[model samples]
Target: MLGDRFVYVAISTILAFSYYILPQKNEHYPTCPTVEIYRPLNYSENKDILDKIINDETFRNSSLYKMQQAIRINTTSFNDDLPLDVGNNLDKFQHFTKFHNFLKDEFKLVYENLQLNMVNHFGLVYIWEGSNTSMKPLLLMAHQDTSPINLKTLNQWIHEPLSGDYDGKYLYGRGSGDCKNLLIGHLEAIEELIKIGFKPRRTVILSYGFDEEISGFRNENPKFIENIYGPNSMYAIVDEGGVSLMNVGETKLAVVGTAEKGYLDLSISIEKQGGHSSIVDKRTAIGIMGQLIVEIDNNEMPTYFIDKNPTFYQYVCLAENSIDIDTKLKNDIFNSQIDQNANENVRNFINKDKYTAYAIKTSQAIDIINGGEKINALPEYVELMINSRVAVEENITIAYNKFVKDTTNIAERYNLGLNVQMAYSDEIIEVIPATEMGKLTIKPITMLEPSPITPIGDKHWEIFAGSIKHLYEELAYPDSKVVVTPGLGTGNTDTKHYWNLSDHIYRYRPGVLPSVNANSHGVNEYIEFDSHLQIIAFTFEYIQSVDALDD
Candidate 1:
């Protein structure tokens, strides 16, 4: 009996030691309470609007027809190496005016009621005067441009790329998925609000850039953004982003993008002595270029678990909510704050999913490489372009410095002169020796630092997130539970331009997950009619929710 007691105490001691040493799985993390409200006067009226959106066939068809009309007009922006005023390019830009006309014709009420201001002839800014001018206007943004479709894959589309075909299930088109849906949806919401006699207490400003695909509006027409909506002029800016509702185990997540990755394009040029193929040198420009590419690939940047990064917080939310996540992973994610090993483990797990990995890590791609004019001759010159999406944890200067550091050894070994074109400055940074065999030049074709992260856990965030949750609960899903968490956008958006306009900018487009994932820039690009409706309904409810806020 004494021996049995001793064994029981020994086993209990081991269990206690293990419990203290091992990372424990936490089922609760920081989460915001759902702030859902409907003004008593508009409560029943809003419900009827939602019901008509869902059940009324004529209402639904009208919305669908508007989307089709917007998509049918080809507002495809081209990234040609020429000015807008150049030969034939001006004709290409005329398409935007056609789109503008279509908007005026289709949404007659919106055109009639709201005051429109055309920025630089193409950019659209509409002001819907609210009852109270004291309240800062809510800025709703959507680009009026679509990525130009590749002619090679034009045949791969089910319907013509510009058909705007509705097979009674999917509405097939280019701009339909990526933005026109949001643009038209915003109008649909406003048009419906007008019909229902709902006057907002806060002003509504709709801003649409014509050349978001090419990143033109911000650079060309800064006068409008600076003069009209100067620094911190708006209440909040909501652009098209934050991927639709995603599911983790039984918990559905409405991920809202609080931050976006910076963009940098490094144009690397190598110059070497040219020679006949018969008298080829051991090392040519192409050969050295190949080696540099390999070295850059091998020396990938370490993915850090930054506290400021929204993706890190997203995993924390997932660790607490996702029951189907691996036990070890969940524990590591929770302990990552204090433990370095746990942090690395969480990063590795995040890296396993490539879809979400880019949001946390700086992404590099050898997009364009040019060398060798002929097979019989050694190339005299070669050029390579490396596109990098800078991570939120780092800035443009750090990213640029890292590239220079990584390739310094290779440049030294080949006795090549190094030249770096500074991003923000006009002066060229170079280290060229008189006896150098070759020259290596690195220049940034375009450089944009990561956007300022929108503050979370604030009144604006709660209202934005709460509106999402309320929309999902009341109209979107009705049955499924949704957890609204801040997410990081892997790609840059037009919101990058409007950062100074408001600190409370949110990048989100409400829709179902699977349908939202349907080929954004690829072939078979389409948008489900049902998902489109959700966007319209969310916009309508979201506007009203923000209007009710006191400050």
Candidate 2:
């Protein structure tokens, strides 16, 4: 009997250890076809093409200097005086005029040839007319604005967010790496390309949207570009998104966004009898709101990856390199049958990595909740703002429905009045009578569906990949190898609105590394001066090569 008891305790201990203590990462396994380092047989340029930009020491220094100046100016989006549907984020269009004039002064060659149009008196569009009308134009995009920094966090920065300080190695500011690197880097290349008499046979358009950080109430910039370029006329649109390249231990991957997830905001409000805090009951508005949060937290919709190629996450898992996989891990991913246990392991593995999990399923976060105006008062109302990013397999309607069903159940359990909007429309979908009337209300403040996937089977992919090859060969990891693969952006970018204009949209933030803690779109955002130079070099080659492609 004692022996039986000991065995039972031992088994319990083993199960607990496996469930709680084991590492979430499992990169050692692979059926990954995209794991190999890609090498092209032919060269896009005579290898000397990279020299034109690399050799121009004076030009390179000037470009980086100009970038620093650009960052110093605050283009932070504000609730400005503009029409709501236009989605103007700038405090005023006048704020962008100085930066526009600055660019014109710095890159003389660019403004001279390209017809620089100041859109809506705030946004910018630079046109470089191509010789061939037969070929669609190539578009490069990035944003001019960034997220507003809190005044309270000013001292927390190593360098002030607006100071635009270059600390010997990094150019520091709010928008440095997020989009400015590409934004300025491309312009730098164009200025130099024109100086060297490198003319693009294919029309090249550079779009700088004023508001990309907040994801406008309307996709203003993309729509404007679409109208000018004509619907679906773009050969390709390159924008900032996802990890352009990632480094995992010894293995490196050149990442590109072939598709991106969409997002929406869900607002829930609850009201009850108002009184002093001392008279609080078992179910005040705040108390009921707290429980609802708990239920939502405990009942997150499980991620399903049963179908082999249902989502991009599965495709990435299958395409992962064999060399990265060990025998045991390989068996676990492949030999294991498509059972509940196997699927559970895969789901856990994905959720462990911050990036891959988002690619697999829709995610939720309760970002904002407000109740009493005063602490002492028995709060009469509470509102919760939920931000959800939907996966490619799901739609906005389905995700919104699930939210309604879940929240409704919560309201019923608490016997509270529940009001919620099922979607983006003005009509309120549900009104559950609570202890008080108008006690609860939930509505969607925003909604954007996931983008369509742009497959990689054309010369466009090759030319883009070829650009990576040329840049990496001369620049990237000397020892660590890189495999270029198709990836879906877990978050959206300026490219979101440009989707209809092109069948092929590639989001690659050039001069960025595949590393954690990149500090993008966060405090202490910075970019390596060297990477910026290489990006400029890469852009020069990418456009010149595309110009050579057959019609």
Candidate 3:
């Protein structure tokens, strides 16, 4: 009789796990509506205008040379590996004064004409006052900082990371691609326009902030942003979020970021007691943590392949004709677009493209871990750090509640007493027993929800679509016309702070040159000099296009 009862319970447990892990029936997905986007038929006259601007032999050569000079500066925030720099380390940002001086010299035309002010010297803002002050201003933004270079991989780079070596085709350096390129592109465009004796009809604001790479991102120039372009005063704001160009297979696509994913850091801890490793227990602290990790991993937060809500998938679905995905997969997307029970085949299909898969779901990665001290001693405490990108369909509150419930179930399965409960705020620390809950505790280290999704129907979307279309057309690549799509950025940008002032927030960097060896934080970061020029072209067109907007 006892054996039969144990077997019955075992079968029930297996079935329960199977039901949670593979909820194959809950295929019902929210549907993100597709915007009516049309591909360009003929290259616009704006391309001709941009070509004329770049055709200036004298201006083009000098501007490219000066851009290389700008990249050569050691304007980095830290020395590779050694974060804390002592006296006279030029790259440790003591050279910032020199960098600023170089900018002032290189863009002499900009300073001589445009009114400029330093936001405490750390943040740089340049204002070109338009003739029509009544028109809402356009703000262009890019970060001034870059990630710290890794010393262990320093020798692996083709050129010195700070050398800004231009190898006739590519400009190689730390900040070359991650951001500095965009900043220089904007600056170069303005400088050249000034040389051409061009004056704007509407105000143009350029903002460069520090601390984008740091953990605690503190903006150095709020007052400047306030006094110039205050709340509800700006028409549109652009920042680096997504690539202006991306190629899935044979087809080239121009992607503009309309939304950014939210972030959350969870530290899962399971504590018991420490003893000699030889003294075996039914389950150790590490064992409990393992079970919890497995539970979360196996029963990952449900991902949406299709549903009623608007998602980036809608854009991908529209581009289905362009992408090289299988026809069956495309059919699966449509079949499950509205059903509560979406086809599992569709989920499997979309998840195949790691890039597109993430935009549709909340992602979690276990990044950090801490536990035992010595091999001989058993671990009483185990902690794991999970970094999650919250999806638009879910909030931190809802997602975290699920996490707690999952933890509870997992704990109950192990027959472990979980005296501790989870709370989401700040970093987690190991402590002696305090409250009487049980053995497990989960807490959030950091939490930030996804950014608001900008509407594709707005005038800002039209301007973005137009500017990107023109920019891509001028590239003359992909052996055919490019398709434009609204995308959700997997990462966050400084534009998050500007959400209050502008609703039409866009995150995109103009032109992405496809490369097998791409590294945003690793060795040999670089960008094609021509790709840099495209940003300037896009900036010119975007401003021109928006200037036509009725106030």
Please report the candidate that would top lDDT against the real structure. 1
lDDT: worst 10-residue window of model 2: 33-42
Candidate maximizing TM-score: 1
**Compared with the true structure, what per-residue lDDT tens digits does model 1 show for residues 1-551?**
99999999999999877644554754553443334532333566578888788668898898888888888899998887766433345666888888889998999999988998877667788889999988888999888999899999987888888888998878989987888988899999999889978888999998888888887543333346558657787889998888677877677888889999999989888888887988866778899999999988898877978668887777777766776767777777877776789889988877888787787789889899999998989998899899999998999888877778766767887888888777777777777651447788888878999989888877887778877887777776677677788888888888887788888878898877433487877787887788888888878877887898877
Residue-wise lDDT of candidate 3 within 383-425, one digit each (tens)? 8888888877778877777777767777677655543334554
Per-residue accuracy of model 2 over 252-327 as CA lDDT, tens digit each: 5677778887787788777777888887677777888888788777877657554322243334443354354333
Please identify model 1 stretches exceeding 4 Å from their true place: 1-41, 82-89, 218-226, 432-436, 514-516
Deviating ranges (above 4 Å) for candidate 2: 1-49, 52-60, 79-82, 85-91, 306-326, 331-341, 436-438, 478-480, 514-516
Clashes per candidate (backbone, < 3 Å): 0, 11, 23
TM-score of each: 0.93, 0.86, 0.80
> TM-score ranking from best to worst?
1, 2, 3
Error of 2 at 291 (Å): 1.2
TM-score for candidate 3, please give it.
Answer: 0.80
